[model samples]
Target: MGEPSVDNMFSTASNKPHSRRKRMLSNVYSKSHIMANEALKAQISTIIYDRFLPYLASTFDDTPPTTTTEQPQTQPGGGGVFNICALLSATTMDIVTGYIFGLNASSNLIDNREELAWFLDLYNSRRSFNFWPQEFPRFTAFVERWMPGYRLSPKWVDEANGEIEKWTADMCERADAQVSSAGAVGGEEKAECVPVVYQQLWKALSKEAKGEEESGGTLSQQLRMSLASEVLDHLAAGFDTSGITLTYIVHELSQHPDIQSRLQKELLTLSPRLVPSSAPAAIPDPKAVDALPVLHAVIWETLRLHSAIPGPQPRFTPAQGCRLGPEEKSYYVPGGVRVSASAGLLHLNEEVYERASEWRPERWLDMDRLDVEKKKDMESRWFWAFGSGGRMCIGSHLAVYQMKYIVAALYSNYSTTIVDDTDIEQSDAYTAPPKSDKLMIKLIKAYT
Candidate 1:
């Protein structure tokens, strides 16, 4: 509520200052940079190939059942099923944090399940509480101040938030140390230590520092908190939304095992395949993964159907009054009114997407069958998984890269089958996940 720019995700923060922030680090997040960055590739390889694969393979005691397609040398976990939702959440955190804080300071949640549980408990369990503070902050604060023991946020929530803050702060300090050391850590180690975003933002903002402000002054504190807030918000949004989308991908693919196998074939075609491995592995070029039509279609379909933030993204009307709706039925609406477009509704338009309710990745790939304009409308107009315009989800590209890689690595090694999916229909809210918050899935290794 306080520093709304890019820091406070909710507020319809202005574009001028937001642009400044974007300029500082947009290159760091660009497709070219991400694809070419050797450090990022190594970080991803370590987290995914080395850590996630080993952890997943260890979840089973018995060999996996062969698929209906009869894929050979498959190993499935006959042992008790694990929560794919939580596992993927941990995976997202590790990957996102590695990219954010550098590999040295990033989370190892994949290897450390207990801490993953604790962090998710602190982060996920508190979603419902956000409605009060986010929607009706003024009224909520008034009630809490006037009435004794009538706090909207429970004491434990404050404590939980403090823990999250502490966790984020520690990462911030470590990233600071890494970037301060500059090129001291050379070779593969240097790549792992590059605090990409942190270093960029610090340098950009440092140019503005007059060096007159004392330690912890309004300028210093605000600057520090702003960076922390931006990174942490990105951290939460990056992991949670991408994780939920990926969970849905696996769920949809599990239900349609044929689709899973089709995807697996596409994934295995890459030069540096993401095979099941405990040893260090090479990460394929981001372009290679992005170029896979099947993979792209599946990711798009999942986002269309299961957008993490399908809710209307609130936008304030311009001060100059604007026309509303189509030209034929347009009306002049006064400025300052809050307006929004919902991806949930936009995506379900029957005209834009045939059998829109259905999970069909072919619609995206079946472009030749569609008229050019129709295809354009579907891909550009109807699709709003990452929102639209200048203030769109800043981490959209990063999310897509992470998701594609994660999905690629996953399907390349193992085929997932739904063990138990109670209440898989997503929770209806700002950042939706499964209502049950658990998509129990069993994994089986699939040999190429």
Candidate 2:
């Protein structure tokens, strides 16, 4: 098919009430929805920090070496094989699932080779094929089934959805089993559960299934499946974005020794270091961590420089078209036209930023330097890290929290200097990572 016509691309079914599912999906893109999601995310994040990190640290033997002075010996000729993308992807997914299903049902893919491989295969394929389905959902769904090479045909989408449904159902079944076993024994021994979210979801489904509420009567099997689909979307989105962001942060820190040193100094100010084992079992209180300005700024700068999903955030022009640009000069984009603005492009706009192309954290430090009008512009339209308006990232707050902890933990315990800086440039994928698999950094332990 030729490029979709402007009319075809932006066509809204005239006079038809928008479908509720469509409205729900649209809400996912809104700012209010994102803020509400952050609260759920924070609860899940605590589990990740308290339980998941320890498990990963132990599995990877990521313990800092005993001595600060000595460098850990490397295997010769085996440089740059560290697949930072895989590490970050697995880490993010594990954390996200922990939040979604509770710790009991969360994935342990970080150390589980087979699971990790399956996940990456699915994830990579989905990312590569997303644009087609998103752009022409109805047509793509039809053609994909019969088409070859573009393997995300209708059959593939069905299979993917089925797998996700089965996975979520299994979690629900397991929770039910635990609840039943506990009930049998006078309900005295509560099973070590994942989180309350899954249990709550299970109860809701059970009530709906029993036809206990008339308003929920229409929400039966298909509805449950749709909810499952949304959950999967959330998990997939949370994982990939966080993973890619962390990969870039690591690359940047490896390149900047002085910045790394200063970050380490800030981390040391935490009463007990932010090291994996140093903290209490739970993550430090979100409020307390959020208060650290330096930690917040470092994460913010890294996010600004290397937004994980840098592609255009697609939004269709409203019917009757809309005005954009400085003078509100009407461009007359046809209704149903797919138009978007990229954070990658916006973040690097030379007008709003000095040395826009340079990776300077100091730009973030001096907000006052810019003239008041420029600062207003920057505040209003410049920063698009988490995105702006209603459709921003839902788990952005939790992502920030995870990134800070990861950065703090790494820098506070070890000093990193780049081993192969040339290969550190990002690839051209939707979720970019270092072009070279290895982000070889020599780590020197830090002592306060």
Candidate 3:
């Protein structure tokens, strides 16, 4: 979105720069690192128990409604009817920011509806104005210079971006300050509150600057922009995609009570369990939660059927022209041409996935029941939720980590039924959210 030097890992085009940035934070985002991080575990516990569950509880009456087979068409008086899409967006924002900036310095949007509404309005406002700048940058730049009286996108888009950038910069400063204070005070108790992502990136950048200075090179002036831009991209994408996926997870589970019941049984199998009274004292081990097959199946199915970033991820052809299509019908394509592949299309290949349009978590569960080659193709070749290869999503592990725990903690205590799903279809966009941006559902306490 800015200068190449200040852009995030995803925006950095050259392999060298992108690989350099990725190396700085790759260790922390690794599946092993995320699963074992005590800081992350503490952050998840605080967000899920202290913030998320309490907020859900506040939505219902003092006494939880008794479980029943008959689903209600509607309910009134704080009847646990909540716009789940909005709630999920807020929940994921808190979780993602907590890991980025530490639980002590993060936005607790789950506890404040007004702040959540304001932030979402500011964020989603920019989606409509992305076409010209993203698709046709040259034309947008030409128009801006030649047609001074007219504007392709409104002025407020700039204001919105400024506000977001300012907010990110503030978080960076807060994190830096926390690190300094931690060192000065010999902070021991707050070990679990470390701003893992920010600290790793800042230290890595500083180290590079120090090495450059020793070699008689000038110090970089854009360090602040680099750090802020990278983390802002992380925060935005992390929260949005996971939130959208989780919303659909809840929607699908609600639609299928049989599936919901089965998921709850699996969640309850954890030792400490994520039930209300047990939390704050203990949260299930993330590894244990991750091992649950039913939970894994449900999450995987939702990700496939309702992928968050379902649109084309564009890439440029290499300078040395390349061949395209199957070897039998290969054709030459000239260098520098833009090419794109879509996950939505790939996942819908009937050969790869039978009855591909349906949401069947059983397919994942039945992988062993299929032939060897068929199973391999589905898992490694066709399933492209977080993409593949070196430039694939770096935060994929963290996203799945938070989602599984969040879902486990949620279904452990309550069961949800759809209250209103009008226009619940996913929007057709690069990063899709629900079209109406709302999915109302009612939560009932699960008492066994």
lDDT leader: 3
For residue 159, what is the lDDT in candidate 3?
A: 88
- Runs off by more than 4 Å, candidate 2: 1-82, 144-169, 172-219, 276-283, 328-330, 366-376, 421-424, 435-438
Tell me model 3's lDDT, rounded to 2 decimals.
Answer: 0.82
TM-score preference between candidates 1 and 3, better one: 3
State the lDDT at 338 in candidate 3.
87
lDDT of 2: 0.57
Q: Looking at candidate 3, what is the lDDT of residue 403?
A: 93
Q: Which candidate gets the maximum TM-score versus the true structure?
A: 3
| lDDT for 384 (candidate 3) | 89
lDDT of 3 by residue, 272-384 (tens): 98866883458888899899999999999999999999968877778998998779998998888988888888899899889999999988996789999999888878888
Candidate 3 pairs with clashing backbones? none
Total clashes for model 1: 1
Between prediction 2 and prediction 3, the one with superior TM-score is 3
Each model's C-alpha lDDT?
A: 0.78, 0.57, 0.82
